[model samples]
Target: MARQGRKPKGRPVSGWVILDKPKGMGSTEAVAKIKWLYFAQKAGHAGTLDPLASGMLPIALGDATKTVPYVMDGRKVYRFTVRWGAETTTDDTEGPVTRASDERPAREAVEALLADYTGEIEQVPPQFSAIKIEGERAYDLARAGETVEIASRLVQVHRLDIVDVPDGETTVFEAECGKGTYVRSIARDMGRDLGCFGHIVDLRRIAVGAFDEEDLVTLDELEDAAQEGREPLDEAAIAAGAKARVTDFRPLDDYILDPATALCDLYEVTLSDDQAGRVRSGNPVLLRGRDAPAFCDEAFATGQGRLVAIGSIEEGSFHPKRVFGGRH
Candidate 1:
């Protein structure tokens, strides 16, 4: 695809990179490699995958980094294979085999257990994780051979479909879950619940937020493209990837949706230009736009049908809390 827009010159570059990460490389390694290729001073990945796992990993550069947290709030999907009868310290193949069992549940039995994992469930994160415990990273504590008790957090497993159940001691599963759901923990928990210890042997992320594996460009492909003077940031190339899905996709001249478009479906209150300017200036504005008996003391303002600013009414004025679409 032909490169769109002018080639940037020392200006801070901002865009998303959906990397089809290769195995044996950690998520941070992939980010570092891409950052070197782009010469981006700032970059971050929305979610992380184990070195043994590979697939859609969204790498946000420059200003795109600001949107990383928002993007990460979306659901994720993974296709992974679990080896039954073995439990690992890290819950994946990378960990040492801490325990083993001879029991192998039938395929029917495994499918029955999947149903119990669907919907909202409580899950404890793995010990080798970034979660902090008493101000120190859990992984740090784990590496120091310290036992840390991590609290269980509630997460939703939107869907858990059994992809394949081979006669051997391995079972393959495809699951869609909300943010913060740990697949490794699920694998370990499944083995325990099924009367057999288990550990993830192979795992591949199919989707992160709206980006899918099919849309990712492998590192080799990207290198070849770069060598051929193909810039993935080109509009055509980006449009073909996951960045296009959640992006505005529309021309700026066209009416811009409120930056809060994702939250538009929820309760909202409109404001006039004068009121919007006041709210933008840190004044508290009332939610008089809606006549259905104002349900909230908090009021938000919109300009040109897009959420321009949000604020809470205090003593008859709305003080702006967040302003979107403005040059930050």
Candidate 2:
């Protein structure tokens, strides 16, 4: 039998698919569906999104998967609603109630407490979380009826604001945070401090790194595209066209973002034939040209707008760390 998942099969399609994940779909499930729909040889998601949450899950295909870490390290923004009366075992609606309260906090009180949650704060993740404890998943242990001591770690909450309070039962909040910040932890802790136990009733991730809500494509859209025969062009074809300077060819599906799209956050250095050749060969070269980006610790090089490598600039020289072989 062929080694499973060792060699990916199908088209070598490479790009980012910004999925508007539905509330019931897990991140892995979404990635699997995308892989099937696109017939991609390789696929992976930038970050994990809980089944209870929805929106903007970035899935990288083929060579795009090489840039997954960059997207994973980027900031995340979410809008979530917290039920004001109880805290759950999982910190969200899927779990049973662990604590309850009758006192609902006022809007003014919630607003006043927002500042305290902003900036860097220590947070303890919920028991039903992915954190590892002695090489075992915390969630796995919790599910097995084991109690584990989870440590609190600092997470950056760039901004946290109350979006609305539709009723005394729930309060909506929009939070912009760095990687590792948990929206569920925010709701759980806030409730305890406010003396009104709470849990995440609804959650949606609106943005991650270079992607945002506007870039999302629903599963229904993917199904429609598949049915209509709309799909990303083959990577081999794209490579051949690039060599022939054929920039006119466009993918049948316009929704597939370029692999370079993930590097939009980095400084860009357009390379000449010689410079690009050196970068592609895993060699460093002195960067030149009026369009060369300013000195930066990290940047990406492109030839004719196609990604060559992600590198660093030091003493006007670009050193390739991760080469893309000039793939489109």
Clash count for each candidate, listed in order shown: 7, 0
lDDT, candidate 2, residue 128? 85
Q: State in Å the error of residue 241, model 1.
A: 35
Instruction: Write down the TM-score for model 2.
Output: 0.89
* Highest lDDT model number: 2
Best by TM-score: 2
Weakest lDDT window of 10 consecutive positions for candidate 1: 249-258
> What's the CA error at residue 73 for candidate 2, in Å?
0.9
Instruction: Give the alpha carbon lDDT tens digit for every residue of 1-328 in model 1.
Output: 9978875543254556778888899999999987766555577898888788878788876655655665588889999999999998888887789989999988888888987899999999999887889899988898899989999999999999889977678989999999889888899999999889899988888887656655576777655544544323677776767332212212211211123433332345567888777766766666553353334454555766656565555544456766544321
The C-alpha lDDT values of all candidates are: 0.72, 0.86
Candidate 1: segments with Cα more than 4 A from true spot:
1-10, 230-328
Q: lDDT score, residue 85, model 2?
A: 86
**Tens digits of lDDT, candidate 2, 1-80:** 88666664667778899999999998999999888777777899999999989998999988899999999999999999
